[model samples]
Target chain A: MSRVRICRVGESQFAAALLPREAAMPEGLSTRSGRRDAARFAVYRNNVGVGLTRALERRYPVTLRLVGEDFFRAMAREYVALAPPTSPVMLAYGSQFPEFVENFPPAAGIAYLADVARLEDAMASAFHAADEACLAMDALMAIPPDQLGDVRLTAHPAARLVSSPHPVGTIYARHGQDAVSPVTHWCAETVLVTRPHIRCEMQVLPVEEAGFAAALFSDEALGPAAEQAASRGGFDFGRALLRLVSAGAFSAAVNSAEKEARHA
Target chain B: MSIAFSKRGPRLGFFEVHAENYMGEGGLPHHQLRSIAERYPLSLHGVGLSIGGEGDLDRDHLKRLRRLVERYRPASFSEHLAWSTHESAFFNDLLPLPYTPETLERVARHVAEAQDILGVRMLLENPSTYLVFEESTIDEIDFLAAVSNRTGCGLLLDVNNVVVSSINHRLDPFAYVDRFPLDKVGEIHLAGYDEVTDEAGERLLIDAHASEILPDVFDLYRHTLRRFGPLPTLIEWDNDVPEFPLLFAEAERVTAALQEAWRLQPEAAARRSAA
Candidate 1:
């Protein structure tokens, strides 16, 4: 019964449930004339399903480009059936799709298909994320060095920290473009996509930098967050901080009472 | 096509944001809408608020929507004259509804309720459906007119959609011009649709808005202008978006149409001759 409800409008459930299965439906759920109602419902079901599938295809272009139209549409059809868009704004739909592609049977051949979706999802979120005035260095500098450890800085509203076991950014980049590149990692990648202006552009970062940003986003103070990143080998702590600051990755400077007095 | 706004600093167009995108757990979407609110007027276009639902209205959704309108002070607000309901479930597309009295009264009540809460008039756009219900008792033109008369809501005539619905249903598009209440129209939409053939070679015009406006759609807009007078017109090219220059050029086409209409308005022409 739950499964039938999940099929939505495009689903021809009543047509599927012909004479052999006539007696099973609960009252108010399916009718004796179920096929007629279901057929009429399918028109909208198909339309809604098609619209959402198209939105997903737009979001994950690289995945689509690599798989070709027929294969991708088939996958999109399945994905749509599984994760239908409940929201009317097409832009915000398909957040769960990347994870779905990872387990989808036909897509088993493409091991990193899920990660490609992750990058695309993050990019969409970043593109539509709110605009904020990034915190300034001068203000941060004013705080006493000792007090900096206690104050937690807020990450930029548009910045997203994504961590994956598979190299999603590399797959998205390679598949998203007209040309393919060998540099894409089969291993995991950590990425940051920030919409400083109108468009959100993706940048893959070293694990340490990604971890640092993620920590800051969780309200961890700068000093300890840098320490966590510093623990990652080959992490240039100073350069990483500079890159984040330049990108407007921090929205506001959080100050403890001591830190506030120091700045004063 | 030539169209123009009544007065201009930045013009009256708002970022026609989908209502669902901003339903956030307190995040950037709300923040951006607030920031943009300062520079430009916004239109809270409801895509998920199924106004035509048989079920009780989603109060949770309405509460969030009310909060946004209260905070933003948007210039205009709108939703579709369609049901996105699938049985008791909901879909993301603007699902069509039969124009019965029950549906009409329900939609009007919802529109009226929405306006009362938001403390402003609302615009309800007609949807483009691939199929029609046999149970439909009222014509769509009459249905819309009745809603306008009942709720005092404005009309957002999406001309491309009018053409799409007309061609898909094999009806006359210009007839919509006659039935649509011109006095109630507040805004106009001009968008592009894709022309494709189904597997059986049957013609289908989908309101995809992926590219440029078609010539026939432009003609419909001209008729709208002729009937309604020059209103706030927008050229939407959201998908497969070209450069800003191209969009600006499309806006110029609307500007031209409006300029022609302004010149043609009899009183204005007389004043211009006097000057």
Candidate 2:
């Protein structure tokens, strides 16, 4: 009979995810007692899984509402096992959840579930992103043209521009007592999330404008981004600019009045 | 922070809120907590201080904690006796520290420095731990008493934790109640625990705070009531929080018990006089 013990705190923390030392022990009284420890361990494991799932539910109430609570908890449990909290800091957790749902086997049946989660994760990221003031329309008009390319445009840290294959905009707009937005047509919609105030607001963007904003946010020059939008055929640059400004994405627009300083 | 819109201005209840979740802004959670802060006194209950570590307390965690206190102006502040970080690893659970002279000095200095910087007194809550380290020299109650005496800080007697720790270590919990330095006890915590069997075939309860208070714990709490009298007690049901009304009901139970204890005080004095 091999004597065994689960490593103590200094030896190995049960809270940590390491293989238990009791693996080699013979099954009997020790096993029964192990079951007891295992029962205690189950409480902790359940709390971590449920806590993270609830955090996800809070992030994507619309998604949870869409699937219903029973279905949502079941799916969330799967998502949590795959991606348990990597950081003690929860705001830093669940960045991959949107992507996780996209590839989850169970989520395949509900094609729109992943996109809804993506929208929710994007909103969570936007809310916790570094704080910066949005550039007023006047701030942009104040910029000179020469510095436009040289002055790299900086987007709000909280701003997230998402292009989805689902009509998340309409779904999200219908949010009420129901945890999920009403399922609607699967239009390839583009949405922009911005924190103009403490509350998060999402707006559906026209394809033409989304292209320009996405490119610019990725540090692409305006000329290329505009050219990319132009290549999209029937992309209206003038209307896109008006929409971008109206959405309050810009922090401060500086022109290359200096002709070379990159605006960050 | 939203001021209460009620004609009565605001309720005078005091409370504590966890600090880590609200460290960053632009979220609705922070906005709601700030609104609550507007109407009531708040305490920044810290989880990451790791004051009892062998190494110096994590400077970054302390600085972040400081920033939160500066912003919120909480009426009180507190942290646990156990450490959360060790050997550069940050364990989310409050792991126990060996009750020894070395740990006592480290934790005492940490508390005094925290008070000096925050310019306010802080309370230390004792931990409910499972395994006892062979490295310790002192008992938990005495270590806490020493820390309070050395640092001039107060104690946050978690009665449920005292009972849990006593059971795990095979000690009489009332002995803990009798030995505890009553003068330094500033506040109290009453919460639930889940019981499991140990390898010795004895029952071991974990402080999970999900279930209702066990009768044995309430009995021990009665001892605490006799020893410490009424302090601002909080019924924390972080896990499986039934509803707002349920939590209020639990608090009412503890408050009613405390009031009953006070109610008997004059009768006890009369009995002593007649004797």
Candidate 3:
């Protein structure tokens, strides 16, 4: 016999039983026909399960394709049961999905899948992230050359960097299309996501460039950021900076001395 | 699937989106919403507020909503009367609420807080449910009317939901509309529902919003308009989104209904005054 737990009119137990299979149906949950109707509860469960699964499928299309439909559905069911969305915004619902994939025992064989999910989640975030005015080249040039060393730059809100041990970006891009070309080799890769245009764009970056970008992202002074880039070896600081700037990644830059002097 | 609103096509009113979909920092969603807002009106229909939840409202979600409202300035803002969040968990479905005095007081308080924080009047939508609460002391119409009366919120009368809920509960759809506080209706919604038979082999209707509006739902909408007059109506097609032309075709059907309602208004008024 199934256990019967009587939940209050507006309580968590009633809501909890609707999502997870393990939760006993709240006593007194009845249809016009009968009390403790399991079939009516199934409809509610289906709504929560299918709705959340569809949301995850949309946010992680690449990951879904990689795992195959049945596998993805099964995995998503487990994820939804474990960690249902805390916010109403479906776009931001799967932030923990990448981490979930990392810990899922069934997905032990696919080491790169989690990183790819991370890349997709970041890309989705960038796609819906807030808009910011690009840092203009003229504005950067107008600053005193001598004071350039003290400038701290902030990347646009839509800009994101993801470094992974696997070539996740290429794998994400190729999985969905008509004809997916096999990757020649696998190696550590870093991806830069930005929405300089209307659509979000992603590009693979060399480790040195990624490291330099990460430094700049943390509000490092330009001089030290470049030095950090140089320490990474064989990176053209000017070329990497130009690429990021041209992509409209940096939104603002302030000279620390100038700001401090103004305050003083 | 994006389409430029054409002057030559069906009379498109405005777009309604789930506010949570566009809450990210900045990107394509913002870009698209910005451009669309420039040309047409918008409505920010929220699903995350959980106004009827037992727990207190989510402050972070409220802040995000306030920011979006400030940015988008949608013509109308609305949310369901049902609760989806409880404590830290947000169930994806719009869970039903019991119509008790205590529940009513809590929902009204939440709605007032949401409106005060958002600085905009919100419209609370009626929810379609699969089951009814035996502990309920008030009717659904009375409960919604009480909430709107207390919180100074408006009603988003979803016609399909009326049809769906009434059928599942074996109530009269038209009578529910008749008892509804139509004077408080700020906008209207028409959508499709899927029909299913429950375990007892009784017919149940699910508000799926996946296809064109059923004829019976359109009739319910017509009946609602006949009583309340034409408010700003919206066509909600959330799933299995058809092509723009097909969706627009369904919208044109609504346009036809509104026109028919307009044509019959004089007769309806005549009958009302005679009675």
Candidate 4:
């Protein structure tokens, strides 16, 4: 069987046919109606484009509503053309769309739009992320007070933190519920996306609390993480910790002893 | 199985989800699917496991599918007979395959491996194609039956796809359904499609699934039920999913058709049960 050559379709050649015909259509495509035509290529292109754009819209509905249908569709089309999905799963398809929007020339006027997209993408990703059991407060309490400084908490698999210079979360929240445009009050805002129970929940964080969460996300121990939060000033550690615990943000607590051993 | 749009869920015979959607590492996908599994029967219809490609089957995808099957224990698992991956790149569309002896051997081997890894039989679905391969040596129905017989897997007869393919290929839709090996079918699918014209002005049908089921498709589905019996049917609305009422209306329409089929042909329903 190995000796006899079997006829095979050239995959790369067929894939190139699906792309916009830069030069000419790849050879040997025929419909039952008759010969190959330019319009046949459009069928494949439309399938890929429309399918991906719908996926992007699903992931970033707030961005779509903010940009309006026409502009969002045009931008999504270009993004799809440039960065076609490597994976077949649509859940992870639009990760680059936020960055694409940030640099897209036409969208320069709407600076906060990029951040809004980032928030939406984070939420969608959080929705499909792997589930992990949240770390209980009792586990954190079990750690000795002196060794607490060395304890680093792991973020839950579904937890995502997005901080932006503009009030992106508020903008996204307003647009998400309806089509009303909110007044663009320029302020920094951070949002935490996590699946506390089965529902994916989004919460806005104050600047100081954002810093504390960022520190812990960067693997800072609880003691130093709290200190960093305190340095931000006006950050009530007990209050923020209670809110985070309630949100199911932390998945596992790494005690100082394990941290020390890993470092050692 | 209820895919709830309202505060409460709609009553469905079973819930079918695209397997690729739940492949993500443990978050809401798992949570919601786990909850749904506890309540209703699940059929994991996979879109990414390209079983007809020239290359070997993706071991990583198989591993993940195995995990999902082990975790959920879905009543049925299915994939398309079409290929999606080519040379290392995933196309995101079910590209058509040329049905020949070599392709048949390849697909049969792939299906067998998939069933072995998942520890259960899987169903292969017929895909809707816009073009025909000049190298093809067998008809679509024969190709599907051959693969099913070769590997101990079942068939998922997507009725909408049969209509679309028959129209595009200029074959009689009714004749295609008549020739289908209905006994091997474990589940059935009905979806919407879009109609376009080729350069030659010939009508071309694409399985878009973005709109309501057309009368032609509904009629074809009724024909399928009468022939194949009232199998576990799924109303697939992938793109532009309508409001809950409209979606449920489609399900109700299917129920109506099933009841009609039974009323008209009691003997066929008995045959379905015996099979």
Question: Chain B TM-score for each model?
Answer: 0.86, 0.89, 0.93, 0.94
Error of 1 at A138 (Å): 3.8
| TM-score winner, 2 or 3 | 3
lDDT tens per residue, model 1, A195-250: 66566667788776888888888888878888888888888866887777667778
Evaluate all candidate structures by whole-model CA lDDT and list the values in order.
Answer: 0.71, 0.70, 0.84, 0.83
For residues A179-207, write the lDDT of model 4, one tens digit per residue.
67765676899999888877789889877
Interface RMSD of 4: 2.9
lDDT of 1 at A9: 27
Note the DockQ of each predicted structure: 0.19, 0.20, 0.58, 0.44
The positional error of residue B174 in candidate 2, measured at the CA in angstroms, is 3.4
Order of all candidates by lDDT, from best down to worst? 3, 4, 1, 2
Error of 4 at A242 (Å): 2.6
Say which prediction, candidate 1 or candidate 2, comes out ahead on DockQ. 2
Scored against the native two-chain complex, candidate 1 gets a DockQ of 0.19
Q: Model 3, range A8-84, lDDT digits (tens) per residue?
A: 45567678687776766666567744455566667778888999999999999999989899999999999998989
Q: Which 10-residue span in candidate 3 chain A carries the lowest summed lDDT?
A: A1-10
- Candidate 3 matches the true fold with a TM-score of 0.90
> Which pairs of residues clash in candidate 3, taking residues 3 or more apart in a chain or in different chains?
A129-B25, A129-B26, A130-B25, A130-B26, A131-B26
Model 2 interface CAPRI class: incorrect
Model 2, DockQ value? 0.20
Q: lDDT by residue for model 2 over A1-264, one digit each (tens)? A: 676543323423433432222332211211222343444344334444566677778777888877789988887777765556543455656778778777878768988778878888888888877656777766656666644544456787778888878887767777644454445565888899888867778898876677788887886765667778898877886578667766767676645435444443
